[model samples]
Each structure stands twice: as C-alpha cells, then as structure tokens.
Target: MSKTDFSASQLIEIAKALAASGQNFIWVVKNGEKTEGEDREEWLPEGFEKKMQGNGLIIRGWAPQMLILDHEAVGGFMTHCGWNSALEGITAGVPMVTWPLSAEQFYNEKLITDVLKIGVAVGAQEWSRGERKILVKMEEIEHAITELMVGEEAEGLRNRTRALKEMARRATEVEGSSYCDLNSLLGDLRAMNLPATRTG
Candidate 1:
C-alpha cells in the first residue's frame, strides 16, 4: 500500500461507480494522513453513505485486508494492484477489479489481467498522483467491477484463482517447493561452514 492516496475528487468518482455497480462491497479508503478537521464527506458523492448504508461498508483508513478477502461472501476485490495486495487476493482465491495507481502496479495489473486472467482493469491510463486529472471514470469502474463480479467470465476467473490459491498453499507446506528450496539453500550454507571449520 506504501502510503498511496487518491485525491478527494477521485474518491468521489470511485464512490459513484461503486454506487452504480449495485453490488455489495467493502471499500477501504486510504487517504494518507488526514488534515486536522478534514471533512470526510468531501471525498464522497452526496448521499453516498446513506445510499450504501446497508449494502456497503466503507472504511476511512486501514482495514483487515486478508480477513476481508478470505471471507467466503467476498466475490471480488477492487484493488490498487499493489504486489502484496495482488498476492493476498490471489491467495484468497478472489478475483479483482484492478485500478493501478503508480509504480509497478500497472505491471501487476498486466500480470493479473493478461497472464493470470483473474482480474479486470479499471482503465487507468496514467498515475493520478493525488491530483484531479480523471485517469479513470465512474463508468469504467462500474464496468470493471461488473465484469469481475458477474457473468461466465467471472466464474472462470474465480476457478483459476482458486486453483492458484491451492498452489500457493501447497508451496508453503512441509516438503513443498518453498520449503524444499529454503532447506536446499540452508544445506549449501552448512556445507560451506564444514570446509571453514575443517580448515580452522
């Protein structure tokens, strides 16, 4: 996440799209450090909270991302395409609506969309960098979410993600790829130490 923050105007745009999606969601808005007495309403479309009261949960700051993604009720994730966030979503077997903001996120989006085929991109062409340029609009966002959450494409995405999730789980188990690789590295180091001790 690395202290990334979207501008208030962008947040409003996202709110509008989420409202248009008509899907249940939990949005975590990370607006970096808040100013003293900052008005939170400025970040949302008018009556947005009220309209989403029963259907959505909007967290103003940090939230338990893994817990949310691991929940069975969570069908899709709207992510910034950060590496950790992408991996978390994948491990949770959740398909994503990717909105890459900056850095390697755009590349991560490519992996999720082009390589993994488990995510839909929100059509962000450039980094907003907390400014008021409309890189992605509400309609694009709504479309991405809808694509990731509905239809046969969505089902295929979920199945692939679930398979990846199982592979990730296996990698960390005893005698699995990750475990074996770590043990091999340790064995090499220990062998090096044996020669050093004999020479000493």
Candidate 2:
C-alpha cells in the first residue's frame, strides 16, 4: 500500500505540535517528481520549506524499509495500521498511533489495540465504524500524535512489546522451546528408522 495521504499543512501542524511538546519528529514527504497527480508545491503550505530549514525535521521523499522504526530517535509511529507496518513496529518495539484508512485497516487496528495491546488506535470504537474513511482534523492528529509520543498508556504498550521481544528471544535460544521441539523431531525420525538397515 502507498504511504499515507497526509497534506503538507497536516505535516506542519504535526511537526509544530511535536516541537511545542518537546518531542523530536520528522515530517516525511514524497518527492514531487516521483509523486503522481498534483505537485508537492500545491499540497504544501506556505513557508513550509522555510519552517523545515535546519529544524531536525526530515522532509525526505522516501525512507528505507524498517530504518525509521529502527532509529533511536524515532519514539513513535503515526501509521495506517497495515499489517507489515504493525509487525515492523512490534519487532522494533516502537509504539504506534493507528490511523487506519480502510476496513481491513480497522481490523489491523483492533489487532494492535485489542489483541496485541501494543498500539493506540486513533478514533477507534467498540461498536461503531471508526474514523477510517474520514479525514482527520489537525487537532485530532496533533492530539493522537502527542498521546502516542508521551502518554503513560503508550509507555505501557512499549513495555509490553519489549517483554514480548524478550520472550521471542528466549523461545529461539539453544535450550529454548523451538530447540526442544527440533530435538524431539529428530528423535522421532531416528525411532522411525528400521534398526539401522540390519545389513550394515
């Protein structure tokens, strides 16, 4: 799936909110030439270039896969709740603000919010269709980003994700669950072999 359809005004608003809240954030945008349809200039707000000048906010057209989540500076993810993105966030132990864009994404949001408990779902509801189809206002965006960046709830989710990471590590160790399963499989294979071919 394509990256989010965040406008430049929205990007600026989020950047300003993060800066005001003392959170370091980078606003990533698609390169004009590489993007389809309207140009980036048309979508971008006035003075956006000047606002981004040397503020530690990256306005790159593309980011390497998993690089942003792996970075120490990346504290949280503002995401569309795609399964791949969710897995990347979980593997990296980064908390997320789920802004799902479709029905499938809503399901993904439930996985992150209800099942995994590793991320916050923006505008999520227990019984209603969420704000997936709606365009999020600047205030809502700012609030969600801020909450995911520093809220105690987000921190709790981060801690749980870290614990899960440790558990996975232990499960794959030399004397771990998977190792024991492999050993048992090997023993069963040996037992199935008929008396080492009697002739030899």
Top lDDT model: 1
Every candidate's lDDT: 0.84, 0.67
Tens digit of lDDT per residue, candidate 2, span 11-72? 45555555455556666666664223556655545665566566546555777747867887
Clashing pairs in 2: none
Q: What tens digits encode model 1's per-residue C-alpha lDDT throughout 40-149?
A: 55677777888899999888777888998999999998888989999999999999888888878899999999999999998888875665366478889889998988
Root-mean-square deviation per candidate = 4.2, 7.2
Model 2 scores what on Cα lDDT? 0.67
Q: What is the number of backbone collisions in each predicted candidate, taken in the order shown? A: 0, 0
